[model samples]
Target: MRQRRWFPPLALAVGLFAINVVARLIIRLGFDGNDAASGRASIIMFAVIGLTMAVWTFLACQRKRPSDWLLPDLVVGAIAALLLTVLVGPFISGGEPFKDGAGDFFAQIWLYAGFAIVGTLLGYWLAVLLGRDYRSRALKAFAERSKSKPRKVVRR
Candidate 1:
């Protein structure tokens, strides 16, 4: 049976949201009422998210073309995850989404976007440098195949 096109993006979104949920839960339960600690934890959570995205991108680039995965999978998933994190994540921490004001809300969005972009770039660049990305691997295979096959002679 063929897999659905939406499944991968949806799965990725859910995984990213789960990470947010866990981080929110930890902050709520363990760092509640501690402003400094909460700030530190939030930084750590964002860092984790960035690292997760980096690893995810690295592995994905190995198997699929960026054109194939970048839009349909990564962007969709990241957007979904961003929405969930912005709208639903606060509830996990026992708070409303906009309780901290619009500025803070926008700040969160910026942070998420910045980290995601940086992570993705880092992952893709690393894969390209290592010649492990799909394009690199495909080119290598093509070169090997051409080398193995001899050129045919043309009849006069």
Candidate 2:
């Protein structure tokens, strides 16, 4: 086993945090005048984050070692997003952190988790369908090359 590098996952987590900030900003700017609209906007923002994660997962699967990025990358990214949502978002909104109903807070967590799972599945399946998934493509290429060569037996 090799020691995993931290920089990529750290960068990914930072990127996730930036996404949360941008989403919050967008919701704040575009829907602040109406509470209902703001809530909808927030939900859309969360969906976008999930979509981003899905795309990232697909790209990561194109590599020889998809596992390298799957678990840690997502774990760190989700944590970063969660922290930003819980700790920073309310402050930016000029409200106490966690002031909103518990349902809203829990909803955020559920929405984020759902998005991450859906994104990961979407990415993985897309890679498989495109014949670019790490293991699938590797196996295909190996079979092709083996079929092209003649096998020889030696007695020693």
Candidate 3:
């Protein structure tokens, strides 16, 4: 058996962190004094993250069975991305998450976690609804195999 590689999940984590860094840069440099614009950008960033996760989850489910490590990879990748964003991203924007206040820090965490969970659930449920989950695929394969087999002759 071949070992599963971690490159995909690691890349996803880096990509998510990069998105956060871009959002922080836009808020810090482009909309420094404009509260409304900053809020809008933040919301858009969160939406993008949620959508990304959802689409990724959907595609992964289509390609692999649930017993595979897709969900675990997604969870671990999200945690890594969240940690990178909260702990290191602010530094790039020349700000300290805690120095600003605890409220802001916690808010960011809640927003990231909420979006990730919602996205994952939505993706998985949508796949199940569409008959694309592991059980559906397995049942489909079994049905096909059963149909293709030669029927044994038996007369009552």
Candidate 4:
């Protein structure tokens, strides 16, 4: 059976959101009344999410062009995940989205966006540096193939 194109991005979003869910659960159960511990756990969770995106982006860049996967898969998935984390994640922690006010809500969004962008850039840069990205490999192959063929001389 053929798989749908949208499936990947949807799955990516769900996976990212699942990370958030797990973090929330841990924070809720383990650090219920401790603001400091909850803050530390939240930071760790965001870092994990960023790292996940970095690894995902690196692997994706190896198999596909940036134009093919960046906005559609990575950005869309990040946005979807961000929405889920912000809107639904609080429920898991037994709190409302706006319980901490609009400032905190917006801050969370900003942090997610910052981490996502940085992670993606880091992954893509690493791939490019290692010459493992699709474009680099394609260019190297083309150069090698061209070098192997002899150029024809024009007859006077």
Candidate 5:
């Protein structure tokens, strides 16, 4: 059996998680005071995170056709990154991750999931719209099948 490589997705997840940590640390150190500044920092963080996921998804889709492993691996990486951002990031920033409340906790989860899912969908859909996805491949196959003529066997 061929062994599956786990390094690419794992590295991407860890890198994304590190981005979260850096954002948290910056917010904690430089924008910790004014409520408006903190809010802006948080929004910026979320935007950056979302955009990063979108770009990553877009590139992944362009690199290969859709497969079971592609989306699932991306989702897993996003979840892992999200967990690191929420569970461990705040500690590094000298703050509590769930300091706001449980509601905020779940909201972060929802937000991360929403961004990841939307980005993934957008990437794949864009590929499909451009005739570069599995649907396109199947359509091409169907066209070829319809165009080809079957050969008749000659009997003695």
Candidate 6:
């Protein structure tokens, strides 16, 4: 097995973090005055995060071993994004991390996880339909090209 490179995962984490920042800023700016609006914005933010993960998953599947990147990358990226959203976001928005109560905190977690799952499924399925997924396209191309060649036998 090859040693895993840090740059790709780090870059992924950074990208996820940036996504969160954008979502947070958007909510803060657009819906700061209303709690209901802000709550909706929060849900939207989670959805965006899921969409990001889905896209990432699709692209990662373009590699030789999609699982190599998909699982670890998704886990790391999700955790990183969750931490930023749960811990740092509240502070940036001028509130205590857990001041809203345990139920609210758990609700946020559930929402984020749910969105990530939905987004990932959407991305994976889309990639498969487009024939752009890593293994699928590779196998398809291999099958097509193999049919064009005549097999030769050699004496051992």
lDDT of each: 0.90, 0.76, 0.84, 0.92, 0.75, 0.78
Clashing pairs in 6: none
Residue-level lDDT of model 3, residues 78-148, one tens digit each, is 99999998899889889877877989999999999898878877888888899887778889999999999
Candidate 4 residue 86 Cα shift, in angstroms, is 0.2
lDDT score, candidate 5, position 112: 70
Q: Candidate 6, TM-score vs. the true structure?
A: 0.85
Per-residue lDDT of model 6, residues 96-148, tens digit only: 67998999888888887788888888888988889888878889999999999
Q: Which ten-residue region of model 6 has the weakest summed lDDT?
A: 1-10
lDDT of 4: 0.92
- Local error of candidate 1 at residue 104 (angstroms): 0.5
- Per-candidate clashes come to 0, 0, 0, 0, 0, 0
| Model number with the top TM-score | 4
lDDT of 2 by residue, 1-156 (tens): 124577666666677777777766776777677888877777777787778787888887888476677777767767776777777777776665668788877877788778778877898898899988888888999999999999989899
Lowest summed-lDDT stretch of 10 residues in model 5? 1-10
After superposition, the stretches of candidate 6 with alpha carbons farther than 4 Å from their true spots are 1-4, 153-156
Residue-wise C-alpha lDDT for candidate 5, range 51-131, written one tens digit per residue: 777777666665565674476668678878988888988788787878989898888788777776777777777777787
**Ten-residue segment with the worst summed lDDT in candidate 3?**
1-10
Which candidate order results from sorting by lDDT in descending order? Answer: 4, 1, 3, 6, 2, 5
Angstrom error of the Cα, residue 9, model 1: value is: 0.9
TM-score of each: 0.95, 0.86, 0.87, 0.96, 0.78, 0.85
Candidate 2, TM-score vs. the true structure? 0.86
RMSD of each candidate relative to the true structure: 1.4, 3.1, 2.8, 1.3, 3.5, 3.1
lDDT of 3 at 124: 81
- Local error of candidate 3 at residue 107 (angstroms): 1.1
Which residue pairs show collisions in model 4? none
Question: How far is 46's C-alpha from truth in model 5 (Å)?
Answer: 1.9
